[model samples]
Target: MVGERKQEKDVKREKVRGAQDKGRKTERKGQKSKRTECADFTDKPRIFPAEVIAGKPVDISCTFDTTCNGTAPVLTWDTPTDVSGSISNTVTQHGVTLTYTSVLTLTASLKHHGQTLTCRVRYPSVSSERTLILTVQYAPQDLSMTSLDMINASLINIIEGNSTVIICSVKSFPASNLTWRHLNVPMNRTSSNNELWLVIPHVTSRDTGDYECVAENEHGAVEGSITITVEHAPRNLSMTSLDMINASWINIIEGNSTVIICSVESFPVSNLTWRHLNVTMNRTRSNNELWLVIPHVTSRDTGDYECVAENEHGAVEGSITITVELIICCVESFPASNLTWRHLNVSMNRTCSSNELWLVIPHVTSRDTGDYVCVAENEHGAVEGSITIIVEHTPQNLSMTSIDMINASWINIIEGNPTVIICSVKSFPVSNLMWQHLNVPMNRTSSNNELWLVIPHVTSRDTGDYECVAENEHGAVEGSITITVEHAPRNLSMTFLDMINSSSVNIIEGNSAVIICSVASFPASNLTWRHLNVTMNRTSSNNELWLVIPHVTSSDTGDYECAAENDHGAVEWSITITVECRDSSEWTAGLLTAGIMLNLFVAGILTFVYVRKSKTATEERVAEISDIELSPSPLTVKHQGKQNMLLTDPRNTTREGETSAPQGSL
Candidate 1:
């Protein structure tokens, strides 16, 4: 029994001794790896994306790709400022596939204005720690600009094709995108470092408007705007009338006036003026007529007349010539001789030979009584005789006694006969008794007492003026008388016709009326109408008169007057008419289509109202939630165990403009 007890104690002692040997071997292995492993850890503790955002949140962390131990090491974050707080391990393991998140807020601090933050990780067995430093900085801010305040361009300015530039210099912390906009059009953008520019090609009126620029940063935003304007001048200039000339012989009897006009076509309109030999006559638009009234003139007021037109661009001038002559005569005794008569200051031999000739004066006016003389010359020296005399004209009396002296009568002949009119007058010298028809003379007699006119198959062509003139070695005189060659009107008819449709009758609108002034008459009489309360426009047809309304309205229904007049006399006719209006509802089986259109229009309005209501409801819900989030209070807390205590914040994890809180917080 003693030997068995001693054997059990020895077995126990050997077990205890084996356990101690294993522990020593593990200790030696751990110590052996310290130096060699540290040399193998070549991954230089990197921190990715080191830029700091001012007034915003950022993540702070590093990579640890070395050491494969089961225990997690301690990670310490130390900034250049005391604003940094403790961090926790977001993910935990020992070596492979292990991650950690920061518990402290990575916000900008005063001490870390231009400095950096470093994270150091250490294992319990290692004597030194691995470190990574991240740059702690803020984004750009505070932008400045410089340029001209207002740029004024000239009147007729042009920006040659794509070469117009408006440049503005800017000073900013960071480079920004520059944009330009006009109130007339959409915005255009460009990018530069410290300056922004807006360029335009061929600037037109549409390019003139308000322009703007904007600069922004993580802290805040700022902007500026300006206005641009463009201008233009004028266009399209021209002139008026081309020519104006006075009569060759100014024969103003007495108490008469002459008026002339000149004009120009311009954008702003122009003025007219008449300049006559240093005499300026000003005229305006309303009083543009230049009137020259001569009252009972004897012999004066003769000069060159000129018309000048002026405007903003320049001036132009035109002229005409004029002359005036005198007409006067004085009475003398019966034995006194007449004034000298010069035949255009040239001499001519007498065709009729009557020796011992004496000059005789016949019935004459003041114009023909100027001068008279007679010269007789044989093969010897010439003998001259002169007469300075005054003459007066007497009105011819058409009494019975005068009618016998001057025979005058009318007679009818055959269609192709030669008609002759004779007027034998008894006076000191022969007097002219002219026979005229319609103020125009036929080829009958010229300065002779006999008239012979011939017509070949006479018709209406044989109508109009017929005259017989008589003058002998004195002043000439004329007398005219009209003759009516009656016959049927050429191209005559009595057919009822339509002017508009050429049919017997035409359909018209109830609100409109047509004046059918149709007349089928002889002698081609003129058409005339005198209608009150209705407008008139005479549209002459080949054989009809289209008396049209100025316009067609509901009140165009009344009696109309129609007249046909000729040289013989005038005749009147009358007619009453009614008007009708066009009906817009005269659709042929189209009422169903109109009904469908009205139904669709109502349905569209209902759909629009329903969509508007739905959008309003959604906006109300969003507004209520936004009010709750704006209040600074912690409603929901994310509990990420111990690591989340320093890293998690409600404001940091919320979306922009969204309400992030628990239901109770609202």
Candidate 2:
């Protein structure tokens, strides 16, 4: 308002000066013919308002007082933004004194600040001008917020212990005072020029939130905000204990509530959880702390309890143990006495503060199911109390065994014999043992830990793998062993000439005869052919024996026996070989051969004496017939079989086109 009044006073003074100069000039001119002279400013031309507000309208005027021969000076304006409007000119004549005034209504902007604004007054012979630098006043605008070192970081996100610099800048007439605010609350800061800077060094998780930048002046205040997020990994995990009890071991009474607390320090408010035996539990959390409550404790609820805190960075956890102990109290006697808790026969040696004794068992399995005894002894007498703890578990040490002398992999059973096989197992709460052969369940007689499978007479069909499956309420297990049935030779028979299987056979005199004996047995039973109850030949190959008699004479005809034997027993099957005797033809031919042999016999005696004398013929005759027992003593010789047989000395008598059966010892 003061600037507007000063501009009005300057305009009035210029008009008065113009009136004084024009009056003298007008008097001089009136005395002559009324002619106008070139106008000159009696008062200097002036432009009002050196400073202006941006984006607002203000009138700028330039007034000139001229020695008037009654002509007004023309005025024009030059401005920074190239603004053009009508410039009003007023010319006043007071007795030939004239004053010229020009006004331009202008709206300045920030671009016109510090630039030149000019108003020029012109006459035909004289010209004058007024120029001033424009100062623009405006509220803070075109506001921007950024980090000084980071690119496009209006909002900052960095790891913990890192640094970031934030800056707030704007355009204003009198440079704005920049301030920083957090969560809409202004923060005190040092004075700055044009721009506000917030230096956050060594940022922690507490530094994460909204931070706003405000740039203000007398005109107006403008603000911009940025978010700073500081990331810190989860760390410093702890499981706190409320009482003086150990953190890892907490013994609580039954039907009492047990609370476990876990705490951690982190950013972004870590998620907290509780777990028991790897299963999640209901938990409540507040800030960086987590808690879990377990009510009505029992032996089933005894296990490890864990607390976990998790976030985007990482996760941390802590664990504690809780148990409900078995208490055995009271050692009352005539006087005060001490008591001891023992597991079976061994002393537990765990101390307690009072008379009550506690037995704590952790992670009980099948092996831990047994009786626990507590004995209290003093100088007078000894008393005892016992408690039994049973844990249910699966079968252990399951196996199948046989009473027979056998190896680990297999059990051998002979035919027509009784064998006992047993399946046993060890487990808690009594386990049922079952027997299976090739997946077929066997009806077995079960006693305590053993199940018996009795085979009254083992046969070839019983040779297979057997399974023993033990089961309880907890689980089941199975074991297996192979059983093989053994038998002696059976179904012995003889085939005559390899073409007949019978017990008896007939043959013609001077005809060839052949017989084969075969039997079936495990471990390959030995097969033998006998004649007249005398051992003939035996072969162990394929459990078969061959008897070859090339020429069937009456001496060769007898009962031929085929026998098969193994370690178990022996069996015999006989074939009667009947040879037909020759009739009168044999008698006539024998008489003719005897008459001819009589003539040669006398001559052969002389020739035989000559050959025999050279080699002791008397001794050679005795040796040749020594094996043929003429007395028929039938010398008994015990062999590898159960029967005794006749013996003959070994000799090889080979005849052309005839093959003899195996002779003994040759």
What's the alpha carbon RMSD for model 2? 34.8
For this target, which candidate reaches the highest lDDT against the unseen true structure?
2
Candidate 1 residue runs with Cα over 4 Å from true position? 1-43, 46-53, 63-74, 78-86, 89-104, 109-115, 122-164, 167-178, 190-196, 201-208, 214-222, 229-666
- Residue 327, candidate 1: Cα error in Å is 34
- Give RMSD to native, each candidate: 36.8, 34.8
Model 1 lDDT vs. the true structure?
0.41
lDDT digits (tens) for residues 377-487 of candidate 2:
656777777765554444555555677635544577787788888777665446677788877888643335578888888897787677676665445556666676668
**Cα lDDT of model 1 by residue, 82-191, tens digit:** 56455555655442334543444576643355454555666656523333333333333443333343444211223223235565444333455555555635466655
Number of clashing pairs per prediction, in order: 28, 5
lDDT of each: 0.41, 0.64
Error of 1 at 321 (Å): 27
